[model samples]
Target chain A: MPNQDEIFTWVHTAVEAGANVAFALSGLLAGIRKQLDVVGICVVMGLAAFGGGTLRDVLLDRRPFFWVDHPGWLWVLIGTAVAAIYLLRTTHYEFTERAIQWPDALGLGLFTASGTQLALAAGTPALPAVLMGVISATFGGILRDVVCNEIPTALRDRRPYAVCAFVGGWVYVFAVRFEVPPATGFLLAAGSATGLRAAAL
Target chain B: MPNQDEIFTWVHTAVEAGANVAFALSGLLAGIRKQLDVVGICVVMGLAAFGGGTLRDVLLDRRPFFWVDHPGWLWVLIGTAVAAIYLLRTTHYEFTERAIQWPDALGLGLFTASGTQLALAAGTPALPAVLMGVISATFGGILRDVVCNEIPTALRDRRPYAVCAFVGGWVYVFAVRFEVPPATGFLLAAGSATGLRAAAL
Candidate 1:
């Protein structure tokens, strides 16, 4: 079995990557529903994929945005969006709309955990760190919705969306405050947040 | 008479303060229309007042957000919101709706010039600086509308809004390129942008 440090690194990388994909997928579906052209579609997809993380990085004063550091994700997102457009052409609107919730929930969980973790690592105090997580988990979808000319469903829906992220952030914070292993905290936080959002959906 | 440098400083301060007040008032009006409570009113107002500038600062990795440095603005904003609530309660919706445009336009002009100038000072390339100006001038209202569960008037209105900012940003860039006085650049850029938006209204 791998050491705790390797496990923590692996979990960290996975959560970030998973959140990026989930957010991008959600954004792409939203853009498609809006009947945006390819360029517009790509822009929204990229925003959903990178917006929250970039905001987190900006607030934390981290340099070289993840997308900048890894241009490969852009190509992959575009390719996926194009392929999905054709694949989902016959897919029902109701189906696509329903499909969005899954990725959105997953992204919320993953981003909340990762954003909070990163802030804690940067020495931010607990409450502000939790807020950073909520912002990271929620703002991308908000930006996408705003650009698409809709009230962000995150705010509009009666569902507990940002609340889940907030609670999940505190979960991670407390886990760290105690002596829980970092990887375990991440798993528990992400799981609970995603589960809460999924239940709301 | 004050020298050119003194005039530049005065103009800079005036434009930034003007933009902040305009944005804040616009947000306050929006919140009142939405019938949000006072706390909601204040949150939305602050977002419109500071969202764009905060976004610019984050993107540029600037430390000490404008609000953090000037807590006095918070008190002023809250006090103004309270005053406006009572003062404008008897005002007609049509009149208030029309009123929002003026301050919003003024904010657009001032923020566009200031954002672009700050980016230029930070050594961002001309095109990126212009883009930054647009973001700074526009995102605050977008944020306000998003929270208010309405389509952002910036995107919905048929008037060429963001385009005006773009053109004005270029005007500033060109003025600087030609070595016009900095104050003159600000005045010309702000005037043209505000004029263009006012014409649109």
Candidate 2:
């Protein structure tokens, strides 16, 4: 159970790793659905990967957003999407599904925690922070669905996706307020989110 | 030149009509691309139509956003997209393009004016208001581009799109500051935008 600074650093590292994996898998899914080309794959992956954080920063009026600060962030998605698309062409759907779930779950958890933290830092109240957390966790997928011309899976389906984010976010908030060690709280929230999602599946 | 109130009325009318057309077009494009079912078409259309305004409101932190206040706005896009998609398979692209461009131009002009006006209302400085106007005019297309996995057309090729918006926005700002009638300023701004886009093409 590390303190706040260490927990924040850990969260950042996890999110970056998770984002790359999510970007790759999302591209593979888009290609499998035949709604994307090589260029489209990379584009969707990048957009889906970065859209949430960009929205968070814009709303907070934080200049030089994550993708802007780290130019490599954008390219990571580009490279991952390209590679994923190529590999997906010959891979089995079952294997792809099996491989993608964990990273996606990681991204969902890390984003939920980080988004809540951002909102709190920006002086948003608890309810709004929770909403922002869910938005940060799920907005990328919604954007992807809209662009792909599908009903957003989050809105249409009764999945545990956003619900897990909401619960995890509240857990993080309560833990922080109680002065619990941040790392322990973050891990607990993420672990619970992953468990819920896996159970839902 | 029309009075301020009259100009505002016209601009509002144009937005209403253009919103319908934009929504319709999103469905038509999605259908042509064969990426969606009818429900998906409706979702895409609604998002395309309201997406810009929603983004603007979120960035501006204006509570009870336009769409939230008027749920009818959502229905309007839904109906329009449905009708357009149903009629689209039998239509010719060239003819459709010609008819749609007029409303789109009107929408662009009005959106630019409204965006500038809103920014000014929010007490943003003149230059920022002008920039906001341009963003309002072009953001829908950017949203469309992102969803379709293309570089934002505005940022891609130099098309005089944002330039037209900036000039028109300044026209509105100057008129308002000179105590010219609001409607007169609006028409001048909208007309300037419409003509510039036409001429550019």
Candidate 3:
């Protein structure tokens, strides 16, 4: 197994890069579906990309927040929102509810893994660490839905959204305890969550 | 004037005790109006009481969150929710939307002053400190409204909700700068916000 520090750094960077884009796309789609203005779309997209991490950081007492330090993520969110808007305007493909699920699931898995890892690194207990992971995965979508004046899907959807993240968080925690390689464990955990969400849809 | 240290301590305690009760009552009324289940009422009340402070503490990287230290707040929230429910059942008084505005405004002002003070104590710059004050005042209501599946009144209400908090926050900040007595400053700031909101209503 690689050094834990290295694993932590890698997981953080990977989640930041991959999950931001996935969640941003998900938010953009939701915004478009809600028929929000461009500014509203950007706001929702930013919330989806950064909301969970911001919540996690606040709970864990991490300073400056993830997006505050990484202004690049904001740029990425804005760019994606703009591109999505342009594509919808110019293209024949209709952005459907199903399209949102794919990116949302992917982002959920990635964020759950990363949040769990960070909490554990900060010496949080196993249960709260797992809860943090779930929060990181689901809170963004909750904020987006709330801002759009809809009941958050995480709270009301019959489909297993938060449940998928919770289970996947436990999977990642167990993988680390068993000394599975970091990259491999990340994939297993994230894949489990993404696959479950996709199947549910 | 009392020492700034004493003033800070007094403001923190005052806001904690008063705002928790006020906001909890507001949440209970909203929950009752929405016809939420008991658990939903508790959850909404807890969010209204702790949401803004949690946001503030998280942003400031304050550890062992306020409620974590004062579990008493949870009991107070539960007690208030239960009492409010009992009162509604036993009394002829109907819970009206207007009934909520009074407590909400009081909590808003107190929270704004305390939040700004804490941020400044932590050495944050002026504008961000003021912004933190506004956040501490308004975010709880935003969370409450969102959970109830309504657009946050702070965001959409034509009446001066957040604006009152913003103005009153600056009032508290300048009061301190001008060496006003702590108790007087507190009352002035809180009253300004509450009065403005009441007038708007």
Top candidate, metric DockQ = 3
In the range B118-158, model 3's lDDT, one tens digit per residue, is 88889988778888989888888788887989778789878
lDDT of each: 0.81, 0.69, 0.79
Q: Lowest lDDT 10-mer window, candidate 3 chain B?
A: B35-44
Give fnat of each prediction, in order: 0.21, 0.05, 0.28
Show the lowest summed lDDT stretch of 10 residues, model 1 chain B.
B91-100
Clashes of 3: 0
For residues A51-77, could you state the per-residue lDDT of candidate 3 as single tens digits?
888888778877798787888878877
Model 2, span B35-64: residue lDDT tens: 555544554554456566666666667655
Model 1: which docking level applies? incorrect
TM-score of chain A of each: 0.88, 0.85, 0.84
Clashing pairs in 2: B2-B184, B3-B183, B4-B182, B4-B183
Interface RMSD of 1: 5.0
Clashing pairs in 1: none
Instruction: Tell me the alpha-carbon RMSD of every candidate.
Output: 7.0, 8.9, 7.0
- Cα displacement (angstroms), candidate 3, residue A91, comes to 3.2
Which residue runs does candidate 3 get wrong by more than 4 Å? A1-18, A36-40, A58-79, A123-131, A146-151, A166-200, B1-46, B58-61, B67-139, B146-201
Residue pairs clashing in model 3 are none
Interface RMSD of each: 5.0, 7.5, 4.6
Candidate 1 Cα errors over 4 Å, as ranges: A90-94, A178-180, B1-46, B59-61, B66-201
